[model samples]
Target: MFKYAWICKNPDLKGMARRAILQAMDTKPYSTWLEIDLGAIKNNIKQLKAMTGTRLMAVIKANAYGHGVLTVAKAAEQAGASWLGVARMEEALNLRAAGIKSEVMVLGYTSPVM
Candidate 1:
């Protein structure tokens, strides 16, 4: 069995209601998993672009920190990121294969043998 709990010092009623609904939903038991809000990523990217007033790069290295590189990269690009940064040539190649058109920078060294 899985237990879900939300503890907050100042709880908003609406937020509590939402949390209750989420807890009621069926989910498989897993030792670990990730729940990513892609909309939040996009919104944050937009906010950063607005604040910086300069081109921004969305680093999707390490599979976007395990949040799915392709999805995160697309959201970041759509939200006005001028470039995507990856840690390796393979990661950049994967993005290109996925039809990601944004400019990509591999911040790590690539082996000549590859």
Candidate 2:
């Protein structure tokens, strides 16, 4: 089990992120869980963008390293990610199905027959 609190400097963003985490916990009680601070993810993306002075491609493969792909992807996009990277076409499709409009790239090999 993991627990965390929203510590973003932006008050509005902090509130939204905190609510999202709390909602997730509420929906999945009594199960092993990892509490991801979405606010931290957003802040890190923003910082990286500032440091690089270029657009960023957020790699959200493997359920965002087990942090919930959809949630992390949305937060990254909101924080100015220009693209999303995944390991498979199915992951990309799942993102699209969830209404993620960010440009996506499948980094893994695909069978020609598919």
Candidate 3:
């Protein structure tokens, strides 16, 4: 199995590259994946609101714990999450790209020197 790691000229190709990598990985002895249910997330958020009676904030850091950050954030927003938490600026940027208007907080460390 070949581990392909390369930067593409077109940024949008990254997802395609990821798929190719996964397909290549299928030949490996071990692999992993996570299945996320947006319906479940919405239901859970509703339950939290009912129990706490307070606005809920969702932490989607670490690529939403490997559950696709954009999908989770959108569901969370629709489910009444006032804010989304991310550990990297890239994650926040991705949320913005997805047209998410909810506030996104970056919990990762930043350098002032830049």
Candidate 4:
């Protein structure tokens, strides 16, 4: 079983929480972190769902393409996504580790022998 090592941080204080830590500006020190706007994502998903009138599958991988996976998955789940797609077993396991109960598929494939 793979373990989830990523930590979700409050971006406001730390600045955009990314792979590399960004120092807060000294001149105009404020919340430099880019906060995840989950509500907006949810709204967008809702709009898409209404527009398409079909099921929506959220493809989240590569740590949500550097957008943070766990938080994005949680937001996608809340946004009425019926399915979630990842890139590898570890990524799928990470979503499960994060308490996401939605359907998740790993699109990344490896060699049979690996």
Best by TM-score: 1
Q: Residue 39 CA error for candidate 4 (Å)?
A: 1.2
Candidate 1: the clashing residue pairs are: none
Q: Which wins on lDDT, candidate 1 or candidate 3?
A: 1
Error of 2 at 113 (Å): 3.2
**For residues 1-114, could you state the per-residue lDDT of candidate 4 as single tens digits?**
222244557766344443333233224656667767888889998999999999899888898887888888989999899999998888888788879999998888955774
For candidate 1, write residues 28-51 as lDDT tens digits.
687986789989999999999899
Model 2 RMSD, rounded to 1 decimal: 16.6
Worst 10 residues of 3 by lDDT: 26-35
Candidate 2, 39-105: lDDT as tens digits: 9999999999999999999999999998889999999999999999999999999999999999999
Root-mean-square deviation of every model: 12.8, 16.6, 10.1, 12.1
lDDT tens digits, residue span 13-98, model 3: 98888887787677556567667779999999989988999978999999788788888898999999989999988888888998
Candidate 2 stretches with Cα past 4 Å from truth are 1-33
Question: Which 10 consecutive residues of model 4 have the lowest summed lDDT?
Answer: 17-26
Position 13, candidate 2: lDDT: 96
The TM-scores, one per candidate, come to 0.70, 0.69, 0.69, 0.65
Question: What's the alpha carbon RMSD for model 1?
Answer: 12.8
lDDT of each: 0.90, 0.93, 0.87, 0.80
